[model samples]
Target: MTYPPDPYQPPDPYRPSDPYRPLDPYQAVQPPPPDPTPSYPPPYTPTSPAPSSGSGYPPPPPYGGGPAYGPPPGYPPPAKSPFGPPGYGASYGPQNTSAMAIASLVCSIAGVVTCISAPVGVVLGHLAKRQIRETGEGGEGLATAGLWVGYILTVIGVVTALFYAAIFIWAIAEGTNVTTTF
Candidate 1:
């Protein structure tokens, strides 16, 4: 059986007799009562002079007197801009397309219908690129696309022409009779 704590000797520091008791001696002491009267700072007062009954300065005008400073009466309002707001000025409107670039794209499309147009498309595309660099006109992408399509089609056309020419030359050399087949 556990024995009760010694009444005469001091309690052991490592193991307390009562676990709920506070460690600090001052924890159980009560605080002092507050004073009866509370203190506060003095009230504020402005130093500027008040307006007198007979002063020389006139009274301020009524609130709705147009604006303090702006355009005079009967003046026209600002004109609205078509491009954007009033500050943008004349740099608006649709940009001009490069004429040579449009021509290059058209010729490249025509090359699909006729093989002779491929070379013309290539020439026009090169001229368009030069003009676009100098004058800042639009359609640089159109010119580049036309050049690529024209080159690819031109290679195909040349190979097809060579193949047909070889077939005709071989038929002539083989001594085949041509009158009955037609």
Candidate 2:
């Protein structure tokens, strides 16, 4: 007989005793130290803002509708022909050959572009080349280039004029007032 049986007792429910807890995994994962120098910009978002200049140039203009602008302020515009101007060549600095070439190639345009302001692209081109060769000036290419372009343009204009004439003859026989589109 083991004395009177003692009753088994459980731990106290209200009072908590310290219990060992493993370290938190997140605590070990610290965000990398704040970057001292970021390599990339944070972000960019376009909202709404008018351009600083060209305010007059609309979003888009109808083809060949508005007047073409000349060179910027104080800058002289390209002469009528690349080879026309005595002082207009690129070897010294920036040249305007491209403009001259384009202008020379179109007879209608050449008249307005050449410094002499007439059907003189061919003549000017030759003179320009001569000047370039003898005096070491620039624009030899421009003059030679203009001569070819002017010739081509003349041929094109003739063909175009002939086509229009044929159309005019047909219209006259048909007696129809056909309106030519501008």
Candidate 3:
């Protein structure tokens, strides 16, 4: 009677063992030896005609005929970063102009044209100067110009009024001095 196959034996014990495997199953297998001299393809040989002896680079195409190397037609240029460049300190947007300063300038101009708002312009100009000093806003030139214009116009208005009053008084006195024939 045939005995049962041993559990430790390989499934196909009759088949030939692998040539690369170690004789002892427990031993570490060694890799195949490498070739002493590497084999590589033969050096490249150019088939095209030889380049000109002068500069090797080909000449550029005639102006306007070559391909353009910028943004496509109708497309806008790339947007610049608001935060400046790498490693450079950050750049900020424009500072805001003071509203009071603008108002002062407008009122002063109106006063010059209408001769009624000079005092208002002067008051706004002083306020604008104070606000600009505290808040660090722009438009200082506008405030100063308004102040000068307002001051000059106000003084001129006062002097002209006084002169007209004096003339009216002199006319009344001259009329009283003349006796009426009636």
Candidate 4:
């Protein structure tokens, strides 16, 4: 009886017994050895004389020194503005002014003009102040002025109302005759 075919047998006679053999026949051609000397041009050499040690400028630190300012060699210097200093345009933009601050000032001024509106002005001023504190808004001076004006007017209004009520109570208590005539 014939034995079972060997599973590990090579299919082709030309296949190598060694597993590491190159698959391509051209891979057997050896590459040329590396040249003893490099073919690139020589590095740049400065022609100018070195700065004198006695010069006022401090000597540059050795290579690998900490960070330095200005552009590195072979790079052009940064452009400068002719109008102003280095940071001329750094803060360019209109400053943001708070709307509540303006409203508070207007309300306070109106309260002073028309005493009846003192309470409204006081309320607006307080709200504006609170908002200003919560948000870093401008116009703090306006808000402060509004608060002062509104408070003063409110006090005056309260005092005047109390005085009128007291006078009416006193008049009635004095037993004055009351008559209605058309």
**Between the candidate structures 1 and 4, which one is better when assessed by lDDT?**
1
Candidate with maximal TM-score: 3
Off by over 4 Å in 1: 1-92, 176-182
For residues 1-182, write the lDDT of model 3, one tens digit per residue: 33454443324543335746646766655554554553433232465444465454443434685357875544456779997776754347687899999888888878867888987999999999999999888899999998998898889888988999999999999999999887
Candidate ordering by lDDT (highest first):
3, 1, 4, 2
Clashing pairs in 1: none
**Model 4, range 75-158, lDDT digits (tens) per residue?**
456767887675754655665667776777788778767876666666777777788788766777777787788888889878
**lDDT, candidate 2, at 178:** 62
lDDT of 2 by residue, 87-150 (tens): 6444556643444434444443464444243346655565566666666644656666678765
Best by lDDT: 3
- For candidate 2, the per-residue lDDT at 141 reads 62
Instruction: Give the TM-scores of the predictions, in the order they appear.
Output: 0.48, 0.31, 0.51, 0.44
lDDT of 1 at 69: 62
Evaluate residue 67 in candidate 2 and report its C-alpha lDDT on the 0 to 100 scale. 48
RMSD of every prediction: 24.5, 31.8, 23.8, 21.7
TM-score of 2: 0.31
